[model samples]
Target: MDKSIEKKYIPLAAYFEAATKDKITLTFSEIETIMGQPLPNASYLNVSWWKKTKPPLKHFTAWTTFGYSVTEIKLGYYVTFEKPTTDSTSSTPDQDSNDHPTYIIRSIELDDARDVIGLYQQLFAETDYMLYGQNENNVSVQSFRKLISKWKVENSGTMLIAIINGEIGGAIAIIGSTIPRKKHCISIKMGVLEKFTNYGIGTALMTEAENWARTRNITRLELSVMKSNQKAISLYQKFGFVIEGERKKSVKIGSNYMDEFYMAKVFD
Candidate 1:
């Protein structure tokens, strides 16, 4: 998947993201104009493709990510996008002028290994939802430096970290396989410090990951989330991920066996 192919739909996302009306409708031609491309054959032939559905279409994120849904579709004509009745349902960050957090998103560096490790230690201590506990991760900075070098050399993985107040606020990694057969598949892991939970750091990280995946020709992004971690699950769903299956007693925290869900988001 070339980045330009994915970028063609960005205009539509920007259009919807700037929407202020509760309900708006646009003709197929208008949408095409907004997207700078013609609609695919399925857009005219399959009504189901237009319905507001989960695991949305690859291009649908252009609207869905901005909190708009296709409430009604007229095949070969137009579609209606509406905001949810309650503002609580939207996963977008606050639209208020001063509500946005001040942070920068960037890829990791070898010299930052120590900080990254410190971040994971804090994350593990802050929550039990992570794969490793506070003391379980014994990775040395030297090993992490090697890992970072390998990821860069392979060009198949990305580990983005959010910088806030001169410190690492959060990190998100999309790890892909080197094997030709499984190159399209990627696994993701992310975390935000407790203090930055609702500041959109995670959302920004996910968006960047998806953008990177597109440029790299990755098609599937998957992750395992402990069943009890509903907050993380909801965030993932907002990004178009769906629960594909569950693993019973997949994680053991202390003596408690916890179930985890295998979730994935795919781009066609």
Candidate 2:
């Protein structure tokens, strides 16, 4: 769960988060009691309320956060929450959310060099989503090692990778200035596999990276994101990053000139 995750649906999110059991059953009145509000009229009338896709009502995401599924819905009467059993018969340690990938978040290590390079290669191939495509990011292992080594040198930077069963789902890293004058600031970039978007890997990676930055006393963390990347911009904003300026017509891809947004997060 995200620390200080915004309570988009306040009472509902709190109720779901506090439950201790793998499965719990509740009646409509019971749920409404927990929510501290009456259920919406549409929630009771629409069959979609019981289904697990994007809830037309935002409050529905609460239980789904913990892998809760409405096993049986009696309309106005009751709802169920259960830990979905996987084909393995046991759920992966962190895979509580239904259909959510089980992933581990950790700081990158020296031994993970090959995996990191492979990730960059994969990201670079996604020409529509990244600044660097295959032709630009194709680098030798020696060169990439030097780059990561530079980030690691003198407390200047660090990387966080999201792994889902031995494969990198996404990755983010911060590069800090070692020079005394700019040591208070850092910047970063990240990408997830096209197939892995909306799985929360990007959010997890940024959460870990921000934790790392704060511990190192970084006061201002910044990044430049393509103006066209609204999803990335929204994620950055959620992490407290603010757009300070825009670089007009900065990136030229084919005949298109795309602007970039300069964003920063400042810690008090």
Candidate 3:
């Protein structure tokens, strides 16, 4: 995945990140000339064509990661990028300019194990939404180092990590298959520190992971989210992961039980 990391989209993301206003629009010719490529035909006819679907469209997350939204895009001449309608609904960072955090997205390496472990510790502490019990298992540098090395061998699993000012803000992993008949299936696990929840870090990590898996011809991407997590559920749905079923009382916290949904996206 590192050798194939999509570099073309980063420039587009940078343009939006540096914009000063709530909205910025560009002509098709302008965007094409700037991006140095031709636009896809579907991009002219369907708005859904711009969405971050499975197999992962190249440009979707680029505009989404920054504050700008792709509101109006068409064939003839133009596209629009607007600050999402309201603050609460926006995936944009919450802070004002001077203090706003800049996120760096990239694939994980063996040396990132220590920081990634610490990150999961902070994430598990933030909520009861994850599959793992808070503080139940200690995160170890050795364990993660070995896990990363194994990914190198299988070429079937991948983990993408997001960093904010040198700290790990979030990470997502897609583990490979163990069974012969289900060889194309993969399960996804993701966790983000609570403070970084709204900054599009999850979107970036998921897109990277999905793209990596899709590039390798994986057929199924699956995950389980605690039913109580509306935000996480919505995010999954946005990426076309549908709910196949739910398990009643699947997660136990204290004396109460919470439900979880088994969701997946199948690529054709």
Candidate 4:
């Protein structure tokens, strides 16, 4: 199990992991007791809250990481989790070990504002490829919280973060216009921590963002990368983005001016 699972859901995950039965049911209050906290109001009022096994709901990863999924939900009353019936019965250490590192890619939430801000600061300092330099970011926690809330309410954009080894290792943002004439286009910006690069974090984030765009009828996904960032340029090219043009001296890093490639991917 991923230790990065939310603290509140750890106990619940243990409860499910220890279960001998294939199916388990717990009421809202029962779940609250198991987690040592009250269920969020949305859990009681919204069915989507329980049904959505995706990000922005950290608890979903908790149960699913333990091989359980929400089989049924009674809205305010209770929910049931069931383990899939498969021919393979046992999971050994050898079967679990893989070459790649384990990571969770999910939509960003308000609680992640501070961690994200810190991540951006660290990323900016680690490389000049980033748009801002160290200490150049002035985004406040409250301001970031507002931005998250806005993303939740609007259909124009979203942000996703990759949680690796229990920390924010990277994030990607898709920014699009709400105007009817330009709704088909979106711009991408992302960064991975220096130590977390080459572990497929950026690729995973890009894959998720592109899946999201395709589902939303977004046809053009575009971004600008500093010309000197060959690693990023190659990654973009691998994902079908093409260099359409160049912006001369678009970025200034200290005393040096850097050109950037305007790249985009148009979906069929």
Candidate 5:
């Protein structure tokens, strides 16, 4: 049996400032322009926006549940590489071997958006809720194109894709912060291609995202899943996620209000 190394989950805030300034710098205006929305008042620059803002208080509620602590803002993961065990009789594993290398998770790059979107479409094209019911139509090629463009401009690194054998098999997109103060926290949207399910692809992508967020000092990772999607909920729970709350009749699908369960994991 192969030996395994100890892994750690680090807080995002510890590396956020430096990562933003040095790696992924995203301005508030840039994010708004890409997402096609205005910044909420409660954000870092607009403390008063929430008073008049509309629904989707997931972040606001999360912060309140955690006692308005700044440490509550974060949503990604990372991992470090450890030296292989010294077994004289054991031959070194190939570089491509999954067990051979340790990787630090980081934000999704724009160049990878296209492939990631394709993977999402493959996984969710037939689902009842398309893009979490945010889009009028089920996922389509055109929608993926628009999403990629938007992500490219927003500079949000939350979108991630798992690469195996040079192909993308799973993906996740973390929505931008609605409130100014909570901009650091992101809500995730995830999916794995039908054929890729049960193959560890989803876990790998999620692990990478969590590590990426930790590298930037992001403290929390939040997401909402359909009340009926038991498989996804199970996966989130296994990753140390907990149900913080729920939104009743939050999503509208075919004239029906579908409930959503909000789940979160705090790295700190």
Candidate 6:
């Protein structure tokens, strides 16, 4: 981990509240200015309850600044889904009730970049304003390609995608260290399209990511989630993730501040 990147976990809720406050528009250019980097177009943002419920033609808002109009937002929980322990006796069914008959989950390859990008675009497009923060305009195929390229060069983790009816339905990226000193940890980012949600795609992607990490000897997984996203939080808890800390008002969405919950799962 980069010392400058801050190894501490940030709560997802805080991130949301800080990312969206009173603005009505957010764009890649604005995000780059705030994050100090060229943020991916596929990045998420959250819309506030006030904005969603009160507006006939509401615009986007920023977390800290109140005067700007954001055209898009990015919001989602960050969770670390871990591999089950070797000695654990808990049983996970090979197939869940929500698993689709024709969906295929597999490791990502270089040739799959196009599909991966497309799936990500769709996922971003379908994310709810309150759940993700931004609208569909933020998803960029070009930025997604860059991310895939970077991941390929590092090759220190796994990227898995779900295919349904011959089309990409979901994807996740798992990053870990191979160095002897840090082999026991991994980080994960999972996303599923709206149509695929509640259909076992998330569980399948998480299961595969965990298995991949275990194969590499990872014993702990860490992730962050929004405090307000009860659905994702519940899912992580069911998978054995526990709250480790909270980053108070770490993110500024618009005029309001939001907190993020840092959670972790240890598999010894």
User: Which candidate number would show the highest TM-score if scored against the true structure?
Assistant: 4
lDDT score for candidate 5 against the true structure: 0.51
Query: 1 or 5: which has the higher lDDT?
Result: 1
- Report lDDT per candidate: 0.79, 0.73, 0.72, 0.81, 0.51, 0.55
Per-model TM values vs. the true structure:
0.64, 0.63, 0.64, 0.68, 0.51, 0.54
lDDT pick, better of 1 and 6: 1
Tens digits of lDDT, candidate 6, 1-268: 1112221111111222332122123233322322323323234343442134232322222221223222333453221112223444332344223334335566665556655666666665655313244453454656655666676676677688776433567777887775778768877777777776777777878888888777866789888776876887888888888999998976666697778788889987
How does residue 87 of candidate 5 score in lDDT?
56
lDDT of 5 at 14: 16
lDDT of 2 by residue, 71-106 (tens): 777788877767655556455445544545545566
Residue 224 CA displacement from its true place in model 5, Å: 0.4
lDDT per residue (tens digit) for residues 1-268 in model 1: 2133266566566566655555667787666644435778888999777763555246777767767778888898888877775765443334423344446566776756887899999999999999999899899999998999999999988688876533677999878999999999999999999988787888989999998999988899999999999999999999999999999999898999999999999898
**What's the CA error at residue 180 for candidate 6, in Å?**
4.4
- For every model in order, what is the number of clashing pairs? 0, 0, 1, 0, 25, 56
Candidate 2 residue spans exceeding 4 A from truth: 1-98
lDDT winner between 5 and 6, please give it: 6
lDDT of 4 by residue, 117-175 (tens): 98899998899999999999889999999988888888889888876544677999989
Candidate 5, 185-234: lDDT as tens digits:
76777876665567666687778777667775567889988888889898
lDDT of 1 at 192: 97
